[model samples]
Target: MSERPNYETMYILRPDIAEDEVETHTNKYRDLVIENGGTIIDNQQRGKRRLAYNIGKHREGVYVQLNYSGDGKQVGPLERAMRLSEDVIRYLTVKYEGQHSSLGRSTTPVAPMESSAPRQDRDLVGAAAAIPAASDDD
Candidate 1:
């Protein structure tokens, strides 16, 4: 089998849309991807959240995140549908390069090195000790 490229599509829907209508749209896109030869990895409804800045007159939007793997042919149709939908305030699909951080993947935290101490103070003290005291004869 060939290696398929992974992609993540995040879209913002109009906040005022009904919950059932949201489900309809979500299922529509999910089926669309499958029909276009893409396999869905994960689909998440991030729920309604306030936008950083107002998009048009709306202060909040329903967020949907879709992750899939395909041969890159499914993007055009998927994005086209989103572009034509009035309920979709914004949409973006990006080709995932490597390990995605925000996909609920657990990552080991990096521990601080044993020598992780402030060096500036030690350097300053050594520099002061190295310098000769000013003589009155000078």
Candidate 2:
């Protein structure tokens, strides 16, 4: 029998958003998962907190979490939706293999894992890429 796949995604919503708008944004992500044939295991609200630094000039956010079961193929659509959503300030989805991904999605940092990869845009390019053209009179 093929093994089932489970994944979890955490995202932050705009703190200034109206209550009705919050529900709309939350439902959007939920529907995305449902439409993709994935089961939503849980939807958690972590509440607002002060940002470490300003994000869009906002000091707080409505944090949320989603636990789901889906194959590798489903990850992309969910990610794309999050990216396009102005209401969602940031999102990160990680596959919790073997371990139970039961907790509500929150803004808190997840425990570091060993072999997973980081996104390419997060990397620092070499100095050569950063160096400007050497203008010269010499």
Candidate 3:
């Protein structure tokens, strides 16, 4: 068996669906991923929000995000299910390239060096000071 790769999926559902039906749809997709040999790390329901533009005449959608680990072959079926579902307005899946922290974020934080003034700013200031001021005699 191939090693499982980390993946994240975000999907938007039709806003007209009831809360209970939304839960059911969410569970259905989760189960589909698990059944296809994926292990879910996290699942988040972002709730209803307005869409950027009209889709199938929908002005709003309910967003859900799922993080999991699975082999490359598993994605096709999962995406197919979403594509065929009438309630799904849009969906996207992304494979993570490198190691991720427990919450799927980068473990290392990039920090800028502490200084009174950055090198570029200091150079600009010095250049301005070097220019001689104009006089009325000239």
The 0-to-1 C-alpha lDDT of every candidate, in the order given, reads 0.88, 0.79, 0.87
lDDT of 1 by residue, 34-118 (tens): 9999999889999999999999899999999988889988999999999999999999998865444565342445568787665
lDDT score, residue 94, model 3? 93
Can you tell me which runs of candidate 3 are displaced by over 4 Å? Answer: 1-3, 98-104, 108-138
Candidate 3 differs from the real structure by a C-alpha RMSD in angstroms, to one decimal, of 4.9
Worst 10 residues of 3 by lDDT: 98-107
lDDT (Cα, tens digit) per residue for candidate 2, span 1-138: 776677888888889888778778778888889898888878877778777888887889988888888776678898998898888888899886554534443444568878668655534566557878887878
**Can you give the TM-score per candidate against the true fold?**
0.72, 0.69, 0.71
Worst 10 residues of 2 by lDDT: 99-108
Q: How many residue pairs clash (N, CA or C atoms closer than 3 angstroms) in each of the candidate models, in the order given?
A: 0, 1, 0
Report lDDT (Cα) of residue 43, candidate 2: 80
**lDDT score, candidate 2, position 128:** 55
Q: Evaluate model 1: give its lDDT.
A: 0.88
- In model 1, the clashing pairs are none
Model 2 misplaced stretches (Cα beyond 4 Å) = 99-138
Cα RMSDs, all models:
5.7, 10.5, 4.9
> Where does candidate 1 have its weakest 10-residue lDDT segment?
99-108
